[model samples]
Target chain A: MVKEQAHTVSSYEQELDQVRGMLVRMGGIVESQMAMAMAAIVDRDEDAAMEASERDPQVDELEREVETLSIRLLALRAPMAGDLREIVAAMKISGDLERIGDCAASIARRTLRLDAGDARLSPGGLRTMGRLVQENLRRAIDAMSQQDSERAVEVWQSDAAVDELYTAMFRELVTYMMEDPRTIRSCTHLLFIAKNLERIGDHATNIAERVYFAATGEQLPVVRPRGLPVV
Target chain B: MVKEQAHTVSSYEQELDQVRGMLVRMGGIVESQMAMAMAAIVDRDEDAAMEASERDPQVDELEREVETLSIRLLALRAPMAGDLREIVAAMKISGDLERIGDCAASIARRTLRLDAGDARLSPGGLRTMGRLVQENLRRAIDAMSQQDSERAVEVWQSDAAVDELYTAMFRELVTYMMEDPRTIRSCTHLLFIAKNLERIGDHATNIAERVYFAATGEQLPVVRPRGLPVV
Candidate 1:
């Protein structure tokens, strides 16, 4: 009986580990999608844009896989306490990752609309904001895979900078549009690209909170440490 | 043993029912938030905007409540098959409802920043989109409460109209900004407001899909019936 019980326990642990591995893999796909989307804008590479958009379906398929595995564990193992929290967190994290993919695809498609000849719109603010958001996303995914609550908290705190940069980008783009009416279309796309990056940052923060809560069994923070990321 | 098993089964059913009720309540709060947000933009009522934003915390609280109960159901009951689907779907639906609240609050906050004197921006397109979105949100909520897969499918189909109206609004606002540079800031706000409403519609579609899956034990349509809603 003891031997049988040990074997069952080992298999259960393996299943849990499988879920974690899936989440990490999904996170990696999203990270690459973000990189491609950013390159699409910064380099004006249409191929990168199309490639980023193409990866969205894979992210979505991964989300469904995570959902299925988590639900199977819930039904079969009846996980309690921290194990249960981790599974729930994995589910929510997958949702956030899917949204991040959506944001990347949205950004990529918007980049396609931007005029190639408009040397008028400076992507300086956008590039900075995108880089910061990318860093936060990376940290948040790492936190999830490592079960590192402290790293999750760190990612959560860094999101405020992304928000501030986004605000600055918003104002700068509005000024550009007001000054040159001809730049309105391209500038508006840039504004949304900035907003999409900010949203990606927000979703990353959400993943951090879920990761922290799963690792610690406590809510990360009631409100964002600084200015709330809003439209 | 049979009597005890029957008693346990009834209690499990009760718990599942409770989770469903909490989701319905959360859906109701989000619906009202959407209403207040639409009123804020259409009437330019700052008070309505504030009220809409204030209700966000309640939505967040309700989401936690649903999560707690569903997690409890999953861990304690070890529900199987249809019951398992119901609990998982409840958790996901609550997440979507929370996002809808977030979009509503976002629109309300942006409306707070709109210029009071710029009669230059027309809410006609927004008004149309908002109304369509509100109706769809209502139907989606109803579908969840009633467990009507047909109603859920209806909500799914109507989302295309919201997307279409949003595209039209996007073009109209971009044209407005290009024609009159002074309206650029307010029009940008209007653009986001339209986008937010469209996002809320997307969330409703998400909820509809979840509800359909829970009630019928199958995935909803893999792709939307119309244009993919991207920023």
Candidate 2:
């Protein structure tokens, strides 16, 4: 009887570790989706956008698999305290990643919408903003995968800088519209692009919060940092 | 030992029920905030906006309390599959509600921003569009609170209507700005207001999904119904 109990315990532990490993893989897919989406925006590459859209299904499938595995573990293992937090955090983090995938897909759709129009963005500023947002998203996933609270804090700190860029972009787009009525159609698409990047920033912050919860077993009060309009 | 086990079981069940009740109450508060925020937009009432902003803290407090209760339940009860779902669902639903609160406060902030200017929205059509979107938000919440799947379906159907209104509003605002550069500032604020309403509608749909999940332990695939722009 003692041997049987030990065998079952070890098997369950192995299964839990497998779930964690799968989550990290899913995170990588989501991070790649985001980066490709940004590249499609900066390069105006419809093929890249299409590829990102197509890859979204795989992300969706992984999310569903993660949820199923977590639920199965809960039923079979009856995890308690810290183990339970790990499972629950896995579930929530998968959700954040799935939404990140959706945001990427949304960006791809916008790229398609702008395909027939003349590009309206100033190459330098928009590309810089896109790169910054993607880097923040990548760091956020890395932080979560490594369970590094300090790295998560770094992601959190960078949010204000992203917001500042968004505001500047917003002002520039508005000025463009004002300067030439002809720019309206293309500028609207640019607005959508900026908004998508802002949302990616929001999702990155969400991952940071989950990391904090997983490590501390407590939700840090979500304080909207000083610089941006609290959305 | 048998009697002691029975007492503990009953108390644990009671505690779980209390947590559920609190979540429902929090949902009510969030729903009310959405309504008032929309009202402020239509009436242009700063006081209503201020009230909505103030109520945000209450939602925040409720979310924190729900988190604590959920963790405690996991630690103390070691609930089985069904009870575990209920607790986890409560946590997720509260999160959705907190986001709804944030959306409401966002609208309120825009309301305050609008008050500093006299930019009037095109009177008749824009008002009708605003009313339709607000009605959809209210019905969505009602369906969620009552667990009325039929009503939830109705809200889902109305989403296309809101999108149509948004497109029309977009065209009208763009025309107004093109016709007179003077209307630009006010039109920008109005644009933000419209976007905020659209987002509130999205949050309502999110809540409906949670309702579906809680009632049936299955994931609802997000189907983009036929009418809205894919972008």
Candidate 3:
């Protein structure tokens, strides 16, 4: 009887680990999606853009898998305390990661439209913003997989920088449109693309918060650092 | 023994009903947030914008309550099948509704910024778009509380219409910015506000999907209607 009880507990632990592994794997796919989207813009590679778009379905499929597994664990295992928090965090994090993929796909598609416009304008501060957001996403995913609350806090704090950079990009893009109305079509797409990247940063920070809460069993800080958005 | 079992089941049912009630209550707060946000734009009422912004904390508190109650249900009750699905959907729906509140607050904040600028351009088709979005939100909350899958499907189908209106507004706003450089500041804020409303419509549709799935143990249509996004 004791042996049977040991076997059941072991399997439950394995199931919990499996859920975490799936979330980490999903995060990796979403990271590549972000990388491909960024490459699409920096290199103006239409193939990269298409690749990023293609990755979206895969990310979404993984999210559903996480949802299914987490629900099954909830209904079957009846996790308690820390395990319960982690399982709940898995559901919320998967949702955020899925949104991050959507933002990547949206950015990638806009790049294709911008390429078709024949404007070929310089990206200016957009490159800086993209790199910062991409890095934040990486750190957030790292924090999740490593279960490092401190790293999650770091990622959460970096959102302010991304927001500030986005505001700067907004100003620069608007100036481009004002200087030459012919560039409005292209700059407009860039505006949304920049906004999409900023959104990705926000999602990453959301993931970071979930990670921190799940790992530490406490909320981050009362007052999150916020930047003055241009819009 | 049977008497005690009956009592336990009755209280568990009450817990499930409470989670659903919290979600519906949260939805009502979000709908008003959207309404006040629209009023801020239509009547240029700064106080309405402030009210919309203020309501966000209340909405958020309700969402956290839903989350706590749902998590407690999962950990304690270990709901099966339909009840489990409803609990999961409650958590997801509350997240969406909280985001809807965020979008409303963001829109309200931007209205203040728009008013700060001297350019008081006509709203064009934005008024129509806001009304449609508001109506959809109302329908979505009704579907949730009533467990009406058909109403949920209706809200899901209306997303394409909202998206189309948004694209039209995007073009109109760009024209205003192009025609008069002085209007760029105001129009840019308007652009983000329109996007925010479009997002509120999206959150409502997401809630609809959840409500439909929870009520009927089935996913919505695989191919969701999508519009050609201006970005």
Arrange candidates, best lDDT first: 1, 3, 2
Candidate 2: true contacts recovered, fraction: 0.30
What's model 1's lDDT at A75?
A: 77
Standalone chain B TM-score for every prediction: 0.95, 0.84, 0.96
What TM-score does chain A reach in every model?
A: 0.97, 0.92, 0.96
User: lDDT for each of the candidates?
Assistant: 0.89, 0.75, 0.86
The TM-score, computed over Cα atoms with residue i paired to residue i, of candidate 3 is 0.94
Give the per-residue lDDT of model 2 (tens digit) for B1-231.
Answer: 999999999999899878877877887787778777767777777888888888998998998788778878877777766677667767777777787787778777776775344536664555676677668767766776566667767776677777777777777877877787666656665666676666666666766666666566776675635355635
Q: Pick the candidate with the highest TM-score.
A: 1
**How close to the true structure is residue B153 of candidate 2, measured as C-alpha lDDT?**
70
Q: In model 2, how large is the Cα lDDT of residue B84? A: 73
Per residue, candidate 1 scores C-alpha lDDT tens digits across B1-231 of 999999998998898888888888888889888989988888888898999999999989988888888878887888888888888888899999999999999999999888877644777888889999999999999999998999999999988888888898989999988877888989999999998988899999999998898888888756788764656
RMSD of each candidate? 1.7, 2.7, 2.2
Candidate order by TM-score, decreasing, is 1, 3, 2
DockQ of each: 0.76, 0.46, 0.57
Candidate 1 lDDT tens digits, A1-231: 999989988989999999999899999999999999889888888999999999999889889889889888887888899999999999999999999999999899889999877734777778888999999999999999899999999999988898888888899999888887889999989988998999999999999999998988888656787764556
